[model samples]
Target: MRGSVRKILLVFSFVLILLGFWFSTTNAYTFIKGYMLFQTDQTHIVNSAEEPSKQHKDNLKQKKLYTIRPNKGENIGNLLIPKLNATLPIFHGTDEEELENGVGHFDKSVLPGEKDNSVLSGHRDTVFRKLGEVGKGDTLIVETSAGSFTYKIRHVRIVDKDDRTVIVPKPRATLTLSTCYPFDFIGASPERYILVADLISQKLT
Candidate 1:
């Protein structure tokens, strides 16, 4: 009787181990595919209200934060890269799951064109794969339903994981782009690649 009980316990443990392994592998693979899908279909501009904040920036004057939300009857402002002549979707409220589709608005960052800096992030392998292809003078366009805002790539830098300061919101019209570094390395990336952009102009749609 004791032997039979021990055998049953061993079988259950084995089954649990197998199931755990399967779940982990499957989800990781799904997320990787989601990384590719992240090029488009991941914006929720429903956060259409601005708030007051007191954060300091390395540049620009202080101002209130702008609010954002998905377009109601309006369309999502498109994201275009002049160098690749490539374009994709942009949306508000970028979350972990939403990142599986395309560009995600950094919920912590300021909204576009109101006051402080508006930062956006996406998977480098998917939406931002071409981002590495952008040169210093290359152009990034965010055409909202209201107007089109242009930004020129100013500088790109790689930093350690502890450096979250690079993404702080400033009082200027700027765009911040970030992704994991050493793009080809497998099994978790430890570095960050960041792009700093200066707002060039805003054209009404």
Candidate 2:
């Protein structure tokens, strides 16, 4: 009787372990699918414009440039890092769902290409996994309805998560990308990785 009970317990434990693994794998697959949907929707926004070339050029020439202030959860634009080959949608706020889908722009900062710092944040495991791989002089491009702003990386640093100086307003057009440090960490990280770049060019289109 004792041997039979031991065998049954071992089989039950094995089944529980397999079930746990299945649950974890399913969750990860679901999350990836959701993120891919976000990317597809965002890409369509830019590629599906209805205007013709002449009208688009005329509008670009005549339209007055101003800052775009997006509400929380709004899709502001797309961020592209050429070196990292990362193209992700930029959302308005850094809330949980926002970062889970793509990068978020700080509402307090100016929009990209504006005169001041434009702060963007992303999750280390998601859109910004290759952020640390970017080096100085790499280009960061932000394409928006207003225009496209290109920035060249100038500095990179690892700072405490509470550091506010990195996002402070600057005198010139600056871009800051933030992600949690130790990209492979299993749990919450205490440090942040920052990439600072200066606007090298701008195209109003």
Candidate 3:
């Protein structure tokens, strides 16, 4: 009788262990799926939200954002590239290490409507990978809380590391997209890819 009871207890304990592991794995999978979905949906919402009330924050960024240079950090509003289905934190100063994950506001990169050239940089692998799919005429929107500014793609090019022309301050409202080049290269990319666009419109939302 004693031996039989011990065997029964051992079997029940073993079953409970298996059940616990199963539940843990199930919950983990569910949580990961939910998180990924949130990021994907948010990227779309910020990129495409035309509802004025939702984007009221951006309209305030223009005057509030500062002009900090390299090694200096500033929050330069938010960047939304619809073609890439990406919305990323925008920062001032294009420090390469800082740009490893989020969009780096090129220090002298033009504002939406200010000078001739404005540029924003983000990592191609995470927040801006969708940029690779962008084509001519695709819409790029930048939100400042109070409104949105839009741009239309004009051209795309891959330039050598020394091509400094693309970074020059421009005279028209232009958007320049920047990323490490030779995208397919398995090693350190030695080039840069730039997408140039012209401002088509701006509005309060």
Using lDDT as the measure, which candidate wins? 2
Best first by TM-score, ranked: 2, 1, 3
Superposed model 1: Cα runs more than 4 Å off:
1-76
Q: Rank by lDDT, highest first.
A: 2, 3, 1
The digit string of per-residue lDDT tens for model 2 on 1-205 reads 9999999999999999999999989999999999999999988875676446657888766345565457899998999988877789999898898898799998888888888899999998889988889878789999988889999999988999899898898998899999999888778898999999999989997
Model 2: CA > 4 A from native: 1-64
Q: How does candidate 3 fare on TM-score?
A: 0.60
Give the TM-score (vs. native) of candidate 1.
0.61
lDDT of 1 by residue, 1-205 (tens): 9999999999999999999999999999999889867744343222222112222332346333223565322235567778888886766656765567667777666555545677777777888776677767777888766577889988888888679777776767888777777777675778878878788888664
- Whose lDDT is higher: candidate 1's or candidate 2's? 2
| lDDT at residue 32 of model 3 (Cα atoms) | 99
Q: Report the lDDT tens digits of candidate 3 across residue range 93-194.
A: 778765864788777665554547888877666666667788687888877644577888889988886789878876677889888766666666787788
List TM-score per model, in order.
0.61, 0.67, 0.60
Per-model lDDT: 0.71, 0.89, 0.75
lDDT score, candidate 1: 0.71
Model 3 residue 108 distance off true place after TM-score fit, in angstroms = 2.0
Model 2 clashing residue pairs (backbone)? none
Residue 159 local lDDT, model 1: 89
